[model samples]
Target chain A: MSIASHALWVACLGLPALAADRIEGPGLGSPVSAQSVAARNTSIYPDGRGLPEGRGSAGDGRLVYQQKCASCHGERGEGGSGGHLVGRGPLTGSDADKAVGNYWPSATTLFAFTRRAMPMDAPGSLSADDTYAVTAFLLYLNGIVGADEALDARSLPAVRMPNRDGFVWIDAVQPEKPR
Target chain B: MPPVNPSCRAIARCVQSGGAVRAFSVVLDCADTMISPDTQREHSAAVAAQEALSMERWSRSRLNADDQAPVAGGGLLDRRLFLKRGLVFSGAGALAWSSGAAGADQAALPSLRVPGRGFSNYGQPSEQEKRAIRWISANRAVPGNGVSWSPLHALEGIITPSGLHFERHHNGVPDIRIDAHRLLIHGMVERALTFSLADLARYPMRSQMLFVECGGNSNSGWNKEPLQSRAGYLHGLASCSEWAGVPLAVVLDEAGIDPAAKWLIAEGADAAAIHISIPLKKAMDDCMLALYQNGERIRPENGYPLRLIVPGWEGILSIKWLQRLEVAAEPVMARNETAKYTELLPSGKSRMFTFVMDAKSVITSPSPGDTLRSHGLYEVRGLAWSGRGRIRRVDVSADAGKTWAPAQLQEPVLPMCFTRFRIPWNWRGETAVLKSRAIDESGYVQPERDKLVAERGRNGYFHYNAIAAWQVDEDGEVTHVYR
Candidate 1:
């Protein structure tokens, strides 16, 4: 926040307002080892900034999806009580089957999400190889990827999503009105 | 068999029975004077004769007719009528003195003979009050990913009881040991640092009453028809509390920003590790790493130890059980922001990051599922709030939108907090439509359901802050309705 707003914030708390923004603290935070940072960094950016090193293809991922995801998400990502992960429904319709193919805008999200929380029953249980393979398998099922084409951290980020440019950021206080 | 004024109905029964009636009575609830303001304890023949004479006298002389007169369309009366003195119900409450049923149910105190139970280390609501609970609705396959609605209809005032606050879980709450829990702040910063729960508590903190509303709150209002449910079930996804915490600005300034950082990827420790990309600007604003809720160390369900408070923003952005903050130059396009929270319009385009819950209000008492057995005098109470600033005025409409009157707002109306509003209503056994609309200091008026849908198409499912309407039948049964 700007210094003026910061001053107002402090004043609202019934505290004396500070004329200038303080750039220093007691520095109570403790530093961590590189390994500790790596263990904690679970976020994967939109541009594939944190994709783990692993290589896999649709051919190698079919078995992984069947074993870990089929029980809830169905054998072909068609769904079995769980939300369908593969669908191409119209976004303008009420029953918009928003899934990977028609809704998800990034491919790295698949790996980032799988590595952090997937398989419902066992989150964080997938290895980098398993995550990459499962991501590729879902992508192939959605027709965004080929069967034999191997995908690693380098090539995965380059695979463009079908709805990459479909989203629009809104910061206005008003909602959209039809003409 | 048509609905009739309870008092007049009783008078008609008394006149039909030519002989001295057994016992003349009034609706017990309508009689705040205990057993029907002018009723005798004994149901003897002599007392019955005297009661019959009084009923005939009451029928001849209309009581409190001026006070019960409608100020606006329907039965709305002056908002201050409740606070004013005197004005006995007279002919207001449901004349429940059935010419059939005899004695008063609680004329004698049965609990006086039995000793009350001793107090405990922690107290709970009485067995009778246990009905006021969070109604859980989750996915059939993944029970963890669901919502539990608060019982707003069963509550009064503004502050939602901590235990009764609504909850939305992505993959269930995780059991985190405080000592082991660490908040990792990395990425674009001069120094990457970690703060334990103890470390965070030592910082200076401030308390403020603010509401956190889910983006998907009131999404059901976008349905083809009005949902027949309690007010909270439809809109209780939003809740207010007196939150105490260290400002996120303090922590961010201490870490030293890299200047290039534009976004912060906040992730929770739950099994879903549910993450969202927030703009750095909001972090520097009113955001706080909340350490306490409602003057307590927060509940296990409400992110104990630490939860981020993003004042007035969507509830999902609050990030409960918060664990990490990855500062970067761009957003991660998390599933929540891109595919879920985003609104799809009829034009085939979608709008994402529609933050800030606009002005909204709803009548809790006499809402759907509540029946008004008494007709004399009633108080219409409800909650009103806005994300922008303090609530300036809340107008209530009893005959759809035909007419409206300003409700009396509860005192100490703070910004971004729940402000209680109430108005006096004198129901005369007439069918009426009830509704309330909030106006924030920012000059934003809560839209009607039709105008809202006209602007934002049916495909737009989130951020629905439209006026809610309730229909009261002549028989006093209130039900949810669109008109």
Candidate 2:
């Protein structure tokens, strides 16, 4: 049989056996409460569907950084074991290993990253307000925002990154050299 | 399962659960009477103690020094003398102590179970195999400007575990959020278009089992002294996997590629914003916007949400965290293409864009560290692959390059994938060399070490496909050498 046909056959044979096994066998009980599981399953979409109701100011973010983040990220956000969050030089041409604040093209990515995986240990532990605060603080450190600037969902998307235009799509058929 | 005597069973099971051999007093008694004076003289105290109960006794008086003969036909000593084996059996006390020690060792071994933890949403490699990780050898100054080699020696089967796949990063691994990741296609296209990961997922997708090898792999082969490392460490940067994604043509069609546009510049989301210009024909032909690897979403170390998969091309071109594609009229002449990946030829000129990895083969088993026990029938096994096409043949040389024999190539030798080959070899006591050479479908044969050096010149650091030779001495020591 051809590889694809064999794979199909295996899948056909395996699915029923798996279904039967699951029905007949004792299953591992759900660990989390149903309501909590439902809440955790919420996924944010690109068209701004699942955005939470919260606002943060760059001034408030500076206080949050000093209180919680600065111990590891350094006072100026130059980074230590946690990585620098500010003062990025050139985003694309030649030297690219500066900092995330200047290089990242999307402010939405900053908020999303902080909301999902930050503080080294406890991932997904930050509130939406806290995530926005951290994003504002990081942007301020990169000289993208004023110390007292308020950052909300609308303002966050408008904050343009230095390397916003640095990237180009992968055109496989083209022969033009990279800029 | 009980362990049966290998000679008595039709099919011997090498792996057994318990000690099943019974102590035979009669066999032990017979073994004691068969040792010869010459045997005693040849075997030192340690060897004699180990063989006391097992070996056959020989008479010193009948054994002449000049003409030694076989015990069974009229060629050697008396048949009865050979039959009488040695019986210098170990005491019951010692046997009991040995068994007790064995039991203690078994008890000390850790159990493969968790105390409280249970199932996981995602799986990871076993803790015992943690050392089987990609050896990251990045530039010290730059956080992500370097390469990580796949631990090929520690892996089995064709698919490289996603976590251990090699990485060649121009910038650090970007923490890309799935929601924010957008692929933009602009420039010479009829209409500038942007695609979210969900939008790309809506398109029809195909999966391929292939290998991605860094062009600069085995560049150390140009070194004056042979590097002392495992075969995988020397050539582990290459890996094979099943990549699944949407066809590049579908996306290019959506963007409406203009006829004048010949080159496509691919850029990443990382800090470096690394870019590479590829031919438009190659992209529209077989390229893919890969989203899944090995039946799951691509790992963070790999291209998480999306990556450009250039089949059979250099790994660097398979840009991860793909962000943009700008259709252009001419080549971009990226830094990667000009400063790096360019091979300085023996002549003054240099060879650039040498993308496809040529045919290569290496013996993985019976390699450097593994040993052959008792010099009997042994199977020599290894893997061979080619980027140009399928591996047509793998020739194994046991007696150095003196004799070449075809090895059994495992079935389903897919193009641009690893093909396993094995051969049975009877290893005698004489010193010998082992090597393997692969010939691709295009009839491109792997060159010998000397031939490769002669053609490429001493300064050549890339595209090294020299035949690897392993020397085995009388004492069973295997070492790598240029033959």
Candidate 3:
């Protein structure tokens, strides 16, 4: 059956018997503009594109972390209700607390996470500057960056995580049999 | 009538004359309570007069019964004993009422008869079964950013009643108006296309029974001490249903996915605006754009109107309130992927995108909070499933992990749906531990607790499928403990 007819049938099942409604008419009364929605979801590639235009310093991040994040995350990023942000020790074999400095595989992930859903209460409330500052503070807490070092999209991706070389990809070559 | 004992004779005489005698006054007392005050005297007299007649008949019946008596289990009686329907009197002085006169007496009692009410558009379960509800464990500060466990123990049958399905909300559920909802396909597509709910509904549809499990389920197992909870409370974040919708492949084809597109960023329309990056290969392979669940439109708690149903993956990736699908060259590495769903490892590395829920099984009955109640022959029942494939066998060990026996799996074990398993267990008095392990069709046997810890490290939190143990004491109390 045509996709249109199938959709019509589902609609008939979901709603009271109404006459066939045309798919076209004022963009089906959608609230948001198609162009704006598309623009909002810019693609962030692994090789590094779609990074937002902003920069921040670890020294600046210290002020931002104290003002916005320290209440739940603790002063030294030891973690409280929110999780610990700093690494405990080495990033090789077992016995590591694998937090910011040690565990995270990519610095891009840290930037995306903080930008989208951090600070718990007021998510997306922070400006790009504030997000970069917070990211820098977390990196500094994990001992990845100097206290005064600035972080931007280009520089952020280059900051190698301590545990970067520790991981071994699932050996698909000889798939492990179920035990 | 035959001569009665002297004690009975005195009481019978008092009763026959309607005298105020307490002993041997059963007939008179019954008549007094049943009849009105004005007719009580007459009723008592009538019953008293009938008692002498009944006594004469009883003597004749005794003679007839004595003459026709046979040995035990004789006179049309078989050697096999039949279960009795009515109450059995075991104590002395207990009376057994026969059908004819006893039934008539019972029917004469006053009773109120009222007709009950009728049907509704939507039906609720019986009022007595209201305890079957999702136990909400939401974040106190956030309105709806927590998990609610499906009450699996309270439910019977495979399908989780739509109302009580477990919920894991990152943000509060949004009341999105269906008429206003539209899905925009953009990014690395040849042609950017936007489809309304009406337009999407027009696509060819397919239905399959599948389960969605949250990746971080059973994280409590990572704790130093074994957490005490009903099996469902700990692992109830997963549920199975018959999801029907358009194949996502068709949509991707229509949008003309660019050859360079490797990842698809799926975004939701909630206040959190949750987004996640999914590989293009998986999305085009078995993923479904689900509109209906279990033969009905999806419940609001589950993505109403539309959702992406990715088979054999964690529930979070199945974005609800689907607003847009942006094809891309690489993963967005959203917050869920980076910080939240990622698990910190002891080796100073984090495990990201750990999607599949491995094979796991737990004995539902005779579990914690239930007593064995002098166990003799008891049924051990549990649920088992695997995201990789269908469950092949479930081995239940009653003596901890020492000995194992094959369990009976219910038929039609569809891939990725809950398959119920049962086995007959005869329990002796000694304290014992019970464990069940599921082996999927892919030859993946569930890992033991110690083995899991060794492989995944103590600090790892997600995808915990360690064999769970329930210790049964001599007192018949079952408790969760590591054996």
Error of 2 at B283 (Å): 0.8
Candidate 1 chain B worst ten-residue window by lDDT: B21-30
What level of docking quality does candidate 3 show? Answer: incorrect
Q: What TM-score would every model get versus the actual structure? A: 0.83, 0.58, 0.74
Calculate each model's fnat, 2 decimals. 0.53, 0.01, 0.19
Q: Give the TM-score of chain A in candidate 3.
A: 0.70
Which candidate achieves the best DockQ against the true structure?
Answer: 1
DockQ per candidate: 0.30, 0.02, 0.11
CAPRI band of model 1? acceptable
Cα lDDT of model 2 by residue, B41-106, tens digit: 332232222212210111111222123232221111221322245622235423444556556787
- Which candidate achieves the best TM-score against the true structure? 1
Q: Give the TM-score of candidate 1.
A: 0.83
Off by over 4 Å in 2: A1-179, B1-117
* Candidate 1 C-alpha lDDT tens digits along B1-483: 221122332322332232111111111111112222222222122222211111122232233644455678887888877666875545422253322133354445567667888879988898756457676655445556666767787788788889988888877778888889999888888778899988988877888999888887777677666655667767888888999988887888777788988878788889888898888888887788998999998887888778988888888889989899888777787777876788777766778778778898989876876666655556788999998889999999889989998899998799999999998776677898999999999999999999998887776667888999999998777777887
lDDT of each: 0.74, 0.62, 0.66
| Model 2 TM-score on a 0 to 1 scale | 0.58
Candidate 3, residues B1-483, lDDT tens digits: the string is 211112222223333344222111122221222223434343233322322111112111111122222212111111111122442332221322343465557756554254567779987888766445565554333445666767665555567777777777776787989998878888887677777888777766789888788876666565555554556655688777889988787777777789987778898877667888788888887898899998898888888889999888878899998988989766665657654566656555556667677888877776765555553434567888898889999888877777677777887698888888876554555687888899999999999888887777765556778888888789776767787
Against the true structure, whose lDDT is highest? 1
Q: Give the lDDT ranking, best first.
A: 1, 3, 2
